[model samples]
Target: MYQQILAPLFGSLGWSAVAAALPLLVLFALLGLVRMTAWKASLIALAVALAIAMFVYPMPVDQALLSATLGAAFGFFPILWIVINAIWIYQMTVTTGHFDVLQRSFSRISGDRRIQAMIIAFCFGALLEALAGFGTPVAITTVMLLALGISPMTSAVVALVANTAPVAYGALASPLVTLASVTELPLADLGAMTGRQTPLLALFVPMVLVGIIDGVRGVRETLPATLTCGITFAVAQFAASNYVSVPLTDIIAALLAAGATVLLMRVWTPRGAEPPTSEPAGSRAEVLRAYAPYLIIIAVFVVAQLGPIADLLDAVTLKFNWPGLDIRDAGGEALSLTEFKFNWLSGAGSLLLIAGLLTIPVIGISARAALGRYAATYRQLAWAIVTVMTVLAIAYVMNTSGQTATLGTWMAATGGLFAFLSPILGWLGVAVTGSDTSSNSLFGALQVTAAEQAGIDPMLAAAANGSGGVLGKMISPQNLAIAAGAVGMAGREGDLFRRVLPFSLGFLLLMCALIALQATPVLSWMTVM
Candidate 1:
């Protein structure tokens, strides 16, 4: 068994941390500055990480390869699985001409681009994030915004930005659940703390989304609606996560915000409303058909996640150690991450496939046509598949080789300053892995350990990890690939990366400050017990 050494570079944690960071620095520099294609950048970064694992961290070469292979397998099965099926379901809607009807229905709500953005990109996008995390919200919403005649870049940015607030509670609070398991903390406490933190993020996202769609003018004209949507979402999110169910937090907030936006649109319309972007509205029956797929998705997920059903679905999942791989950390404890859980039947992607099949009858599409669309989605997402798999491989190499641990350990060595840097760990994790669940898995225990070392509240730091992770979702290479693919702008991921990078950093800074203050008397009351 190969053992990890945290400080493998001349026995210095600081120098080791810098070495550990080279892969990430190379990735962002290539994607954001050099404008290299995503797949190329990912492959190069993967090479860099593997090299570091073998030479710098002095990991066994075979072990690093196995780790990468495991990650690539995971990336394809679950991560790419979700994206492929979601886009296929969408393509089916387009095939049956329901997508146009859906567009008309939104325009009928209010033709103003800003209002449409608030409703579609922020509110509905949150709903998508609630039920289906990962790249689903960004992929689905970017296309919907494109249908609304929004520019490709703006639609991608809005989808990515709006994806933030609901994320920590996303997929029925999966990220927090993971965090709880890793940190050995109470799930409810982590959920409540995250609820408190992200609602503040929820409060301003609609305004940010509107501004992205139409600049200051959009924010000025749609202040009433954005405020209504944002405030309702923030309040409901706070209540549901704190008092209500954590799993249902995003769902509750998203529905309430959507209802509020719809109610406001009935009485108040934004200034400078444009003409309807689609053909005349379809009959009520057609409208219902247009919406049936998404409804079906929610229903399927809810049923699948129920106690008995969820257990049964999970019963079929396969869990086993990766072949020919065994490694312990510096503490001589085996890394449980080396074991893989193949939740094939119960995975979100499988449920989405079920939802798609159920949708075929409701939307009146033939099974054959649906299959054709599925194959087409595969063809469309080919590069996205490569980019995602390679990126996840990079994540795995970094994780298993102790490259990520070195970085975290080095940062934790900062003592009291670690509170301010806590959220950045999560941000960096998610930026690399593209999932808050994965980020928390990577950094949750690290955060708790560091917080205890620094005399900070472990719960606050743990929650901050997830809260900061949401912002990085916007700039993740996998999400960028998904957004670009959805808007038919594939290979322009570099452009999308450049567009969302500033927003990611800006929000991360704010989250850093919030977490830092929460560790002190200033905002300590805002934290949960």
Candidate 2:
């Protein structure tokens, strides 16, 4: 590993860092600038990582293999699990004919297109994100928008934008929980800090999305509903984060916001009546029964995550390091085994499955039809699942192989502006993978390390990564694909990205400023990253 191999490449600390991070930059550029498929770009990034590990960083081949395999596995389980189940639950409704009733009910509540966008894509999505996360909101929200006759591109963008506020507290507070675990920070503090920060944005993203879709008039008309929705979410977020468990914030807040909207719709109609519906009304009890599955899911997840039950369920957990993969410092020394392990039972996947099981009865479809619907759902989502898995695999390969770290280090050394560069790192991770969770996973450690070196609050930097990651969601390849498919622009993926790019970048900058402000020593303790 010396002279001809590691020395020429990883010989200097500076060189090693550059080698780790440059490929990551190139990966994002290829996707953002060129509009390549996520998996395709990921493969290119992975190849670069392999080169670094074998010839530059010179890790043992076995470790590299193990790490890559483990990373891919991590991508599949819980993450894919969540995405697939969401689509399945929705499919059960569609197949049962109850979904049409559900739609009619939603229409009856608030038929104005703009308000529908707010309640479903923005507000309802938050409920799911908080409850189940891992692409569930997007999957559920995107489909709902499409059914409502909202353009697919519009649905995708709104859902992506709407997704922002719930993300930090999403998957029942997974990001905050993960951050605390990784950094040894207090879980409650991390939850409170990120929670307060998210609601501040959550209060506004809905209105912003409305303006983007419907212009100024749309914004004006929906002001009252927006305030009720936004304020409820923000206050709930702040209170929950500061005083309660991270997982519970989105759940309670979403329930409150959704409740407020439902009540408001009953008493206050908008300027125009709802869109006309040809569908017949079903019994309210039947509708309630139809929705029982979701209620059960939430109830089960809460029980599963709480107190003795959660700890007892812990026995089912299986933890082991990903095979062969190892990290190294500038000196080419290997990282400890603690660097790799799949977090399974504690993950959202388990919750999703439990939710799905509970939802099956509520779906109310018979066995034969249920199987048929499941098959059809799979057929419709084949491209999405393939895209998600491949992209994740490549992301893991590139990361575990050490190329991303080298590249971040290189950028850090050359560009000493921590605040400016730090957000960019988070932004790039999101741009590549299109998942905030993935973005945080990729750069969370790096952001903290950079902040410490720069002498800023580590929590602030970690939060910045999450904040910037939201911008990438609008332009990410996976997201673009969903948008294109939703809008019947199947291959026009590039067009969707081009359209949303500006807004994504703009909001991202705004978030970065917010994060920087929150990170100050005086305010830092007030909000955890």
Candidate 3:
């Protein structure tokens, strides 16, 4: 097996690290500076990564090609799988004329755009993140915002921003699980530290969403509702993640936040709220039918999560070592050899596909019509498919060739200031890989090692990796692809990325401050022992 060499070119770690980052820099420059489309940028970036892997890192050609193929396969099976079906279900509602009723129902709850954003994008979106993450929340909620008459670009941006807070606990605290596994830290302590850190973001994200939706005036007018939602969610998240079950943390938090928002709406209305646009309030049964798709999704996901069902589903999962990709890291540790387990039955994508199919009868559409809609969804998401696959391939190539490790090793040289930079490692990982779980897996041990060397609490640094990684989700290419597809801006992934970059960076800075404080005596008491 070929082993990675971090400082491959000049034997100088700094220069080698800079060379390793060229592919990402190319990606960002093309997307942000040249304003190229996401698909083109991602494809070019993938080519750059392959060249660097071969010439600089000098990875074997067969192994590099296999890595790219595996990444592309994963992107299609699980990532695009979820995006396509989620949008398919929404399209079913539109085709059946039920989306109009759904829109009217939300309007009746709160006519103000600010309140609506808080309720749907922040609150309901968090619920989706808790249950069916991996682009589900962004895909579903962006479309919901569009149905509310929000502009496409604004809807995409708002959904991306609102997705941040719950992501640490998302998919049943998967990111935390990955962190614990990587750092060999106590799971509970890591959860508690993460709980303490991310709730700060939770308390402020609703305000950010409202500001994005309607600016400072929007935040000012809807201050009470925003505060209630944020505070309630933050408190529940902290309590559940620390004191209660980490796996159930986001579920409890999302439900409580949604309940609080609805309860507050009964008594208060934002000042200067415009009159809601009038639409036919369909009968109660029709409204319920309008919601049937999501209900089916929830029920399906819950049942799939049951122990017996999950075990049975696992029986059919395809697992194997990826062919021609066995390799080792610079430290002579063997990299993960297991290929992507094709979790066909239990995956969120399969569940979403099932949800879409079941919605056909509920929405009174024939199987042929549903199939046609599904096909149309594929057509709509063509560019998104390309973009996501290319981005994932780039991530895989960089990871396997040790390009990511080269960068991480360079960052670890920060010494005492590494406390402040810990979260940035996680942020960069997630920004490249598009999953907080992946981020924690990539950087969690690095955080621990860096902390030990820097004379800080290893657990605190590792937990910070997870807490801060959530902020990167909004700006991740996979997520931006999902948002762009959901909002019918399939080729404009860069636009969504540019819009959410500020929020992502701002949240990263806040996380750095919080972590820096925890490392010092100022907030050291907050770190879980």
- TM-scores of all predicted structures: 0.98, 0.85, 0.97
Steric overlap count per candidate: 0, 14, 0
lDDT of each: 0.90, 0.67, 0.87
- Number of the candidate with higher TM-score, 1 or 2: 1
Candidate 3 C-alpha lDDT tens digits along 1-529: 6689988978988998988899899998887778788999999999999999998989999888888998888788788888888899998889889988888888877778777767889888888888788899999999999887789999999999999889988877888887888889988888888889999998899999889888998889888988999999999999998899987888899889989988888888889986554665688899999889988998998888899988998899988778767888888887763367788888888999888888888989888888888889999888999999989999989999889999998999899999999889989998898899888888889888888999999988898888888988888888888899877897787777788898899999999999999999999988745
Task: Give the 10-residue window scoring lowest on summed lDDT in candidate 3.
Answer: 273-282
Off by over 4 Å in 3: 274-280
lDDT of 1 at 48: 97
Q: Look at candidate 1 and give me any clashing residue pairs.
A: none
Candidate order by decreasing lDDT: 1, 3, 2
CA lDDT for candidate 1 = 0.90
* Whole-structure CA lDDT of model 2: 0.67
Ranking by TM-score: 1, 3, 2
Candidate 2, 1-529: lDDT as tens digits:
2111322363675666666665565566666678775456656766676666666766566656565566556556666666666667777877777767777767666777777778888778888887777677777788888777777777777777777777777776766666666566677766765665567677777788788678788788777778888888888878877777677888788878878876776677556546534454578776786566567667777777788887877776776544434455445655432253344665666666667666766666677776676677656666655555555555554555555555566545533367656666777777656677767766777777888888777776776777676667666666665545433455455556666777777777777666666656655655633
